[model samples]
Target: MTQPDDIAPYDLAIIGGGVNGAGIARDAAGRGAKVLLLEARDLASGTSSASTKLVHGGLRYLEYYEFGLVREALGEREVLWRIAPHIVRPMRFVLPHDERQRPRWMLRAGLWLYDHIGGRRTLPGADGIRLDRHVAGEALEADYTHGFEYSDGWVDDARLVVLNAVDAHERGAVIRTHCRMTAARRENGLWHIEAGGEAFSARALVNAGGPGANDIDRLAGLVPARGLRRVRGSHIVVPRLFEHEYAYLLQQPDTRIVFAIPYEGDFTLIGTTDADHSGSLEDVHIDARETEYLLAAVNRSFRRDVTRNDIAWTYSGVRALVDDGSGRPEAATRGYELPLSDEADGAPVLSVYGGKITSYRHLAEEAVDALSKRLPALRGGPWTSKTALPGGDFAATEQPAFIAELNARYPFLSPADATRIARAYGTRAEWWLEGAKNWDDLGIDFGAGLTEAEIAYLQEAEWARSAEDVLWRRSKLGLHMSGAERDGVAAFMREGG
Candidate 1:
């Protein structure tokens, strides 16, 4: 392990723990670069975790005419699913065609381009569907006559970030959670970093601070040629808006669309309103207008009438979109830019701006490629595309069989519990379930299927420090856990369990 007291300078220091930062850390570490990753808070606590949790090509971007960005993201969809099948699963989206919103021909042309542009394979292509005959149609209002069905993938967004950090650590990267970089400066051709009251040195620094990218750049005494426009996206979870497994892509009177996805087996996840965010990054939540907007959009297509009372949970995140001077917040580009500054007498600093979760791996590959030109120590070519993340060695097609196998091995666990474990940890579940033949062997029950054994594993391996870190980020057990149960978890974590 790379100890804190070791004064040896690292080859790279990453400044955030979001998906991009974690991806970069993993890539850099795998390439044999001595790396240090610092997060101001827990991993994926910011924009990473707050995503709509879809790993798609941004179908809506096609309307914006972002062909290059769409192609890149579309190509990454299957690659990401291949490496992390446990977290990324194939999902089919139902787009109900409302003639008032967009012409049917336009939607058809866009879907055609989306299907063809990315060299798509493995996933089924887009096709028109009759609402009267499809299983997805059962949930919609009777008035809806036709729609489109397309393929995308869903991800455990927070877990993806954690897995990347785990992979990075296994490759000898120093993973520091809750370590905020207070200051950074160049001295003697090296970057001196002061984080969490400790001093460290690196040959290069990465400003992967998602929403704070510009702040980090300014802290490094440089201004980005382009600025970032912060946009807030909010989501609401309601008790199973539809019974079907298929997700909905509803069109609104405004050009923007809303998605209603089946979430956590018992809830429907609806979201994502784009509005100009103008507040402290720490305080992001759905306003009444956004909630109303989302509910209205859902009401337009579904037979169900949902209100605030039906909302089981709500979350919001701010995106650091590159300021392209677009008139609408939704019009901002989802592409990323890695601006590298190399001074004559100082080390280089690369700042990441405007990226989506779907393309994080590619962004990291490009970022490290840029850094390797300055530091010759970074070894190896792109390897992550072919590598399996931590526990994702099995084929995506074998998920059901793997879950059944897990249930057979641990007969004491219920089927749901077994499936959850298999999905979350994949083959890695054995690392914690080893030698445990029954429930008692897993230690004290913390409710919501969370056990002391699992908590210990998360703490020891995934850097989970609190109940929020475990329940909210590492897993979505918070949605299923009660207030008293959650408090017990908090108390247990506080008591050093």
Candidate 2:
């Protein structure tokens, strides 16, 4: 294990490589800061990747009077979509109106406010739909005859985190994926940091350790923030249950919302039952009650009842929320809170409390802007809001042409391989393919559209440190590949390691 002292001191050190941490690192590095990003595990292995994968204003928050949050989120929606059209696409979510829930007028008012909030330009506005007359109604129960469809966007959450890190690294940030930040304490007007048993120093410190922010604060010798709530949210995947691309928003009897969105290509991603978590972040798992709660929510709205037997996969994540002492976790604020060191005279460890996948970029920019206050010599201001993320730089209009061009360049590559490469690497796919002339040129196949060439690119270019990085986070081929294929990839990565 190597530490920070093993290398030169950085202007700033970011604790976590999840979305917020990675985004902050990218912003800080882009501004010419000597930045180092340390992640205990693969990036987005926490709440960032386990999100519902939507990059839109939280509609339900309107009821809770989260106007500012919704507005900010809505503004970022189009910006993020334009930056990464291939990974983030507009999704129309149908919110079924049930008398058991709220009245029709109240729901309509919320939808109206939601549609008008951010001055949306790219996505369509909300519309009232008669579920009985539309195909979206096929899954809904007969009692739910009406719904409202509003537009939000879906994202490849893991890809978003990795792309940010890649962009940050490209801008001269040192990112260690499997590296763990063991300790940090301020000394001599600078904070001493250690990772993977190595040590380093930085003028400023950022604790963006998603769920592990608690330990980070203690290690940095700072008192814990007022309220850091760890809430566990889980999702379940099942075979595709509908034909349309639109997602469904069902109101649970408990006033909570459940989303059933079209996921990957063959399955629907449903989830997210929030449960209070007081457990270790490393050991979070989906409780059986959560599974039952989600299943019942779906069955309550859809006529096509699905049971536990239909579940193809399940994932659980812990959201590190800035608990405002809200007894009800569902009503918990989704906005981020920045808690700065109190008694520290010079060197400060700024801790990020709460944030979401949708608002990570803005949150990152905000974090760096705050950091700029401490280090006035920093060169740049907030530049990430408009700038495209790594693979997101290419114009959206050019993606189709670029994919076509990739297919032309790799005549021997299968359509799926070319598409995967195009989506994953964008224009950089050409550089990854290099001069490979044919299928054999791809080296060994690791199954599920994975090639040795791509793996090598990840290892060399991307900060991929393990098989899980390649399979689960870097690319989601794990879901489609056979167990044997995953084992082969693991073996290959272990041999390389």
lDDT of each: 0.92, 0.84
Write the residue-wise lDDT of candidate 1 on 191-214 in tens digits.
888888788889999999988888
True-structure RMSD, every candidate: 1.9, 2.2
Clashes in model 2: which pairs?
A: 2-198, 3-198, 3-199, 4-199, 4-200, 5-199, 5-200
lDDT of 2 by residue, 84-113 (tens): 866777889999889889898998999899
Candidate 2 error regions (>4 Å): 1-8, 342-344, 397-402, 411-417
What TM-score would every model get versus the actual structure? 0.98, 0.95
lDDT of 2 at 303: 70
CA deviation > 4 Å runs, candidate 1: 1-6, 343-345
Best by TM-score: 1
